[model samples]
Target: VSEELLFRGVLLGWFDRLLVERPSSTSLLFLPDDGRYARRGIQGEGWRRWGAIVASSLVFAGLHVGNGPEGHWFGPDLLPLFLLAIALGWSTRQTGRLTPAIGIHMLLNGLTVTLILLGASSS
Candidate 1:
């Protein structure tokens, strides 16, 4: 709940509002100049929105380092976490709401815990 509120509800939400709500004269790769991007809503704004997603996802992944096993930064774990963050952020952006992101986060965490418990019990 807290993590979703912070990352998806706050950070990603802010980014979408700031970078996606407005249009610039900048022409980015894969973005059309006929205002078609804006017409498609979140698909518009090109790289700026993508930049926000990447930035926020990085921060989300970095924040997990201290909470991992041994409380140390694990380089190997960061990539997956970053990817998960990107997915969550993308969901939030697409829905224009945090519910889906929060739901996905909860589901993933639940599955992780279930796997851990299953592994422990089997052992």
Candidate 2:
């Protein structure tokens, strides 16, 4: 459920690496001067808008859909994941910080793992 590593981590990591690997292409992809973290939704300056939150979350989720089978599905299984991303993005935007989003993301991930464990045990 917590595909943050894939979407946010791996995706951003690759993008950053790309800039160094091929500086010529960075501008084409809209890669900013700061870094992947900032571009990936870590707000700066004033508080970000809710529209930005939604847009960023959508992009985050869209990226996650390319990893593998688990990442490709758009059913109920992934709904919560997308919603969690939205919540995380919104939280970060609203507070102009990243801690709250990270906390909520971790909690949701933990809950997902707990539920899966409980279900398997019960079954």
Candidate 3:
């Protein structure tokens, strides 16, 4: 809940407003002249939206770098974390709300914790 609210709700939301809400050709070269990128919530079409998503996800993943074992900043973990962030951001973009993203985040966390616990118990 907190993570989604912070990352998807706040950070991603800010990006959408900055990139999508007030899109300008000068800022986004790929923007079409037809004003088709002016979507109400998510912002510009295709690449533009994807650009924001990727940027936000990267930031999210980068923040997690020092969160791994013994705070060693594992590089390999960043890839999977970035991928998860992308999915969460995409869900938030699709629904124009953070609820779905929160749900997905919780589900993933719960599943991972459960698997870890089960593995520990078995061993």
Give me the candidate number with maximum TM-score.
Answer: 3
Q: How many residue pairs clash in all the candidates, one count each? A: 0, 0, 0
Q: Could you report the Cα RMSD, in angstroms, for every candidate shown?
A: 6.3, 9.5, 5.5
lDDT of each residue in 26-122, candidate 1, tens digit only: 6445466776765666655677788789888988999886665557687777898999999998888888888888888999889988998998899
- Write model 3 residue lDDT over 54-84, tens digit each, in one string: 8889889998887754575867788999999
> Candidate 2 at 109: error in angstroms?
0.5
What TM-score against the true fold does each predicted structure earn?
Answer: 0.72, 0.51, 0.73
Which stretches in model 1 have alpha-carbon errors above 4 Å? Answer: 17-44, 70-72
lDDT digits (tens) for residues 23-120 of candidate 2: 35556477556676444444432233444445556677665564433555565545655686777765654665566766777886688789878988
Top lDDT hit: 1
| lDDT of every model, 2 decimals | 0.81, 0.56, 0.80
Report the C-alpha displacement of residue 75, candidate 3, in angstroms: 2.4
Q: How much lDDT does candidate 3 score?
A: 0.80
As for candidate 2, its clashing pairs are: none
Give the TM-score comparing model 2 with the true structure, all chains together. Answer: 0.51
